[model samples]
Target chain A: MKVMMSLTVNGKLETIAVRPGATLLEVLREDLRLTGTKRGCDHGDCGACTVLVDGEPRLSCITLALQVRGRRVDTIEGLAREGYPHRLQEAFDREGAAQCGFCTPGVLLSAAALLAGNPHPTREEVRDGLAGNLCRCTGFQKIVDAVEAAARGEGDR
Target chain B: MDFLIEQPDTVEEAVRILAERPGAARAVWGGSDLVVEVRDGLSRPEVVVDLTRIRELVEVRETGDGGLSLGAGVPLEHLARRPELAERFGALAEALRAVGSVPLRFGSTLGGNLATASPAADSAPPLLVLEAEVEIAGPGGRRRPALADFFQGPRRTVLGPGEIITRILLPPPPPGARGTYLKFARRRALDLALVSVAALGWPDAEAASGVRFRLAAGAVAPTPLRLPAAEEILAAGRLDEETRTAVRRAVEAAVRPIDDVRAAATYRREMAGTLALRAVDRVLRTLEGGVA
Candidate 1:
């Protein structure tokens, strides 16, 4: 079935027709061409498809496209301001948070959500907050460091 | 079968839709497990009754009997954040804390967890220990069943075709009661349990009595099992070396585990014994006015 839904993506309002079975990841990557939200494990195990649904990190791959109606959706591409990197994105670049970059978008989104809620999270809190995101390449030490740096408002370009 | 997605604002409307749709529709709350199952092709429902829109099912009310009524749509994250739940229903709160990750906890509903009926589901053992009952609504009427009787087998429940779980009633523990939930998983976050145990009971200060315990083991059997024999042994006296050994033996006997990818049946049996002993020992220490 087709469902017409209004989604505010990256601060822009968009009205799109989505299939009931289509996932948010598919809509972001295919329909909207916001390919920054990578699709890893569509089953929600991997955090590669993470996006901010109402400023909270959510697994877009498992979330139905129709469920995001009247909600603000933010992908990794949406985090930047007019080609400028977000604080989290800048920290990732400076601290080498992304090794392979496959998990970068998801990690950035999760970290962004964490920092938005808690700007000064402890190391343990940052680790626990991003526990859902899995990074096989960087071993998560650098990611943890990046999140810590971002939370402290340090190491930003 | 027609694809019908009903967003009912009230319970009556939901029940009416269920009555009209019969077996074709299934109530979806949280959709953490159901959505995954549906996406994986395990369940193909003609109608998806989205219960998230129902505001009435999102409340956490305290009954006059000092018990808690968790609406069917209350997310696990919300349950974990309740200070009163942590202070009063320690086992339940601890179990809620250990379910999946923060994102899954935010999206997963307690009713959905119970309805999924996974033996390893974190909420079930604690609810079993709490002697929780579920209020289920169907076309005919509403019925309440003890949480234990709600499960028929793995991924199965006694809920009729058109029925939906509306609320979970968890009575407060008796005065002087202490409860703890111990989960042994492969990792700290987002891992399924190899074996888990929830112990809830009160201390018997008089005579040779120690803490009377109720032990519920998860992920080792077809359904989470209450180790009554182990509880009996604990109720006999303090869980000293001798009693701990007896309780461990009873727990080992109570569980019927299977060799899965998570762990071997023998390993699960051993872990169940260890967890039961540890949980009982920890609660006993608390009862003795020592911090655990």
Candidate 2:
């Protein structure tokens, strides 16, 4: 029951064969080999599979691949343009926001999703915005600071 | 368990697929809950009639009666920020905000929440208190039913084969009415409610009717319930200490809860009354020109 579906990933159109009930998370990690999105909880509880679908933060683990057929999907891999990291990424690096890095992709994308909608989010807003994502390393303070700095259009050297 | 999935861009196409293959087909909105079921082998839908592409099913429009008619696919993430909706429909806003997490909110739809029909569905009690009605579509066209009659039991609804919920219509609260939805949960995020309460009330001056009030409870019974017996007592009566105590008693007596992993029946019964009093007290304060 593999189905041919076209996905618009990282501004590129790619057609691939996927299982009938394959999730967007599976397609991103396996079929397409875009491993930036992690598989956490495999259910909707953890935001480790967070991705931007049409500029909104959505849980890719629960999203069907068919659901995003013609939609824009921005993953952690899509954060950089022309080989430079996204400002959010730079800010996180400069602030030492990532400890384990397992949660980085999801956290970065979740922050990017928030900054896209609210460019000047407060620190509290950044925390509230990324409440879905969990950092097992438990370095939330730095992550929130990184997001706030990114929202203010500040980046690392 | 392998199956074919169909994405119908239009309601007619979706309905046609469902009508022809009702047993094998299932309609999905957000897929937040349903995807887990399919992935876990709990339910293998031979054909998933994806309804997300039906454009008209996801828009939020102003109703003819000055209320809001939420397209079944309206995402909670988009609805929570509307200051007017949050201020006017506090209970629903709170309940919507209480759903899974921010990321889940972006994909989950209001219609999907109602269609799940879980006794603990966070959106049910809020909709019940707001006097919401739902529009169901099938091969025969559409039928609008009161939200009260929608639920049969846990994971069951009046929705027949080939029928899908298309929109939720909510009547405006009284001019001065204040509404609140409160739920007790294990955690602030990604947790199901242990017990939830929704209340809407207004003083005589702001109320279109005499001391209008409505009450509903969730996760403490077989289905989300409307406390008509309690509403009957609060609707026309003056706000008094004894009357408030009576309201709590009525709610406590009305709940038919059972022991579960989330809570014990005794605790749910007690919290039902506690939350009920708190929900009404907040509204009453607003009615008396005090802080809400």
Candidate 3:
């Protein structure tokens, strides 16, 4: 049975009706049309579906939409500010951090979560923090550089 | 994938719903494992009783006996934040820290790890060494099963259909005991354990009357298991080269491994001893915290 639930997604209030087993990834891409969050492996192994739920990076692929009923969920779509790119996004773009780009949104959000909690993270910390998201391109070094730059409050200037 | 998702606010209500539905109902927290199983058609429960909403299952309280009562729903991410808590249960912290990655850790619950009952579960070996007790709530009210008796097989546990784990009771490590969990994986991050070993030792006790050792192994057998034969030999007293080699051999012999996608059966058997020895040495060096 489909049920109605209210949730705060990317700063918007959404009262969406969804099947009981519908994942947060499904609702984000299909229902709300916010395709920023990509679905890689729906089994939670691939971090390509990563999103921020209550400020923590979580795999949306395995997260039931009903599970985040009244919680705040932030995705890659929420990272920009009034059409202005977020620093992490800017850093990734400037440093050529992304390659294939399928893993970019998830990696960016994971890094966003990292910077939000720890503004000046070490390189190793960045690697460990973003270990969930796999980037087959750029060899992960540039992604680490992008995250480190964002952590130091760089890329905007 | 169409099922009834009920978020019960209290333990009693959740238990009642589960009991009424029996095998048709299942409990979920974090849903990292269950949801995937549901999507893959590996498991089909009519009702998924969300345990996250139940307050009693999501807390981590220090026990009155200088131990810790880990709420089953406590996220693995919480372990990394509390360095103080990690220091106290070093092996468990190591195991959990090695669990998926940072993001998945935010969503993976300890209870889910145990209930999922994967043979390569990183968290189980440490709990085995810590002599943890599982607190379960079922139709009969509550029962605390020792960690040893908890596993029936892969993805199978002793938990009954209507029962949910409320908390896990872990008594503090021996006053001078050092704990260590060593995991070997094909990759460092987001991979299950190929072979892991968790061991605790009292150095002074070892020097005095052979050392008191509690050892457990993972991913090498049906479940994360405590090595009684190895423990008996190590407990017989002393960490001599002969004894160490004997312990390793005993562990290698004890495990019944199988050829899985992750590793070959022979390799798992070989690594089990190597990891076991490393875990023992690791605890010895815990008295020296990364200096070695």
**i-RMS for every candidate:** 3.0, 1.6, 0.8
Off by over 4 Å in 3: B204-210, B288-292
**TM-score attained by model 3:** 0.96
DockQ of each: 0.43, 0.67, 0.88
CA-based DockQ, model 3? 0.88
Give per-model TM-scores: 0.94, 0.94, 0.96
Top candidate, metric TM-score: 3
Q: In candidate 1, residue A38 scores what lDDT?
A: 88
Tens-digit lDDT track of model 3 for A1-157: 6899999998999998999988899999999999989989787877999999999999998888899999999998899999999999999998899888999999998998888888898888899999999878789999998888887778774
The CAPRI-style docking tier of model 1 reads acceptable
Whichever of 1 and 3 has more TM-score, that candidate is: 3
Model 2 misses residue A148 by how many Å?
A: 2.4
Cα lDDT for residue A152, candidate 2: 76
The residue-by-residue lDDT of candidate 1 on A54-153, one tens digit each, is 8877888777776677889998888888788888888889988898898899888888887887889888888877888888889899999988877778
TM-score of chain B of each: 0.94, 0.93, 0.94
Candidate 1 per-residue lDDT over residues B1-292, each given as its tens digit: 1245677888878888877877667777646676677877878877777787788789999997889999988878789889989888989999988887766776788889988898999998889989999999887789999998999889899987678889999987876777899999999888999999998877555425645678899998998888888877777765468877898899999999999887999999999999988887677666545522
Sort the predicted structures by lDDT, highest score first.
3, 2, 1
Query: What's the distance in Å from true for residue B285, model 1?
Result: 3.2
C-alpha positional error of residue B48 in candidate 2 after TM-score superposition, expressed in Å: 0.7
Q: Write the per-residue lDDT of candidate 2 for residues A39-104, one digit (tens) a residue.
A: 988878779999998888888998888888878998999999889989998998888999989888
